[model samples]
Target: MCDFTVAVFRPDDDRLEDAVELLESLGATPVPDPMLAVEPTGASPRDDADYTILTSKTGAELVAGAYPGTDSDGVADGGARTDRWNPGEATLCAVGPKTADALRERGYDPEIVPQEYTSSGLVAALEDRVDGARVEVARSDHGSPVLLEGLEAAGAYVHETVLYRLVRPEGSGDSTELAAAGGLDVACFTSSLTVTNWLEAADERGVRDAALEGLSNATVGVIGEPTGETAVAAGIDVDLVASEATFETLATETVELAAPTYYE
Candidate 1:
């Protein structure tokens, strides 16, 4: 195993577990610090919109769980539950492949997935298609404003449903201590909220300055440019931005940057 340690701040779920396994496979010690938690609102997307968008895999799963015939893997066994909001004639869209996959698993076909996974990318993909259309966006409460504003500017009537809320988990921030102590070798931040919540965690622990100092000595990587900007705005130096906005690519590239010889 390499001597480097990589801190991953994902939600406390399969994403975090998958990150830990991926890091261990790459020979870097994984610091499994969950900075986010999901709170479902029990509100589903509107069925009557001309276009419906889902921004996260968690949102897809939460909505899918409400359906009857959508199996865990998305194979339809019986039929979609009548009690839930069916897509009807709405064209479904996902912000990225992962979210699209989640939707597919739940028996919904995502007709549009932008090459770029950001909110701006979604707007760019749909700007021409959604003019004068009613669009419903379902995702977390922390979704980017760029999506709503861009859609509205393109002549689409946009309504957003907060499928879930992302909050800092009660007992997170162990990685802040490790980072503050200069024990971290690399850190992978997946979103702007992750970056903000992490610093907030550091402040809550009274180690904000120390954590920033420690991260200076470690390689920092984010999933996209927005997240990178957030880190920079928070006085954190980001050494890498994954070419793709996915955790697998982010962790792999961050590991390679931290220990070039480790993978070889």
Candidate 2:
């Protein structure tokens, strides 16, 4: 029996570790590639907005800080920071359950979490309510333009604060070489940035065409439709777009599709 190798591009933090663990548990050889690195921008969400939106667990942690007993009442002393973060009367909104949980861990009670768990879904969830309302969006620099455009189109006065920037980690292209060698059975992309970064890394390594060819032969999975579009635009055949926009869903579906016998 051959090893079912699955390549995952996540950050070096617990996310990457968690991805490896999930892949291993699903009976696949995990290619742990830390593609995304987070850089804090020392910025926090505007508290004066009528509705404050947080797009990811990383964003929530950056704004609220990761300290014990440091609920959203006071400014956290870690990650991104402002003088203070007192929501006062702002209704907190999270893009998904994990982000909402991160906010809750920091003592924030997010009032709105869309069922679809995407930027468009959040926009739809707030479309009727945000008209003429001040909406503050806080997230990474690579956050989707759909979020801001949707909010603006819905008549919301939207302001965005870059809480962090995501960059490709140093020496992160090993997976490109592996993929180009046709050693991977599956590759999971969590965001459009990951797809762009992977290709950029491949280009830098002078294996862009070979890597794309290899991905064509392997099962390529993206977490969301936006990511799928990015992959397709790059000429990478997408084998699966997870029904849910989550790592577990993406990995589980990818592993099952790539090697159903091993996954079972």
Q: Tens digits of per-residue lDDT for model 2 on 1-264? A: 336888898888778888888888887899988789887776777779999999998877667665332345434335334333567689999999999998898789999999998999999999999999999998899999999999999999999999778899988988899888988679999999999999999999999999999998899999889999999999999999999988999999888788854545
- TM-score, per-candidate, Cα-based: 0.91, 0.91
Counting clashing residue pairs in each candidate, in order, gives 1, 0
lDDT, candidates in the order shown: 0.88, 0.86
Q: Candidate 2 — worst ten consecutive residues by lDDT sum?
A: 67-76
Candidate 1 TM-score, true structure as reference: 0.91
* Model 1, span 1-264: residue lDDT tens: 576889998887788889999999988899999988876666778989999999998888877764323455443334422233588899999999999998888788999999899899999999999899999999999998999999999999999998778899998899999998889889999999999999999999999999999999999999888889999999999999999999999999988888964557
Model 2, TM vs. native: 0.91
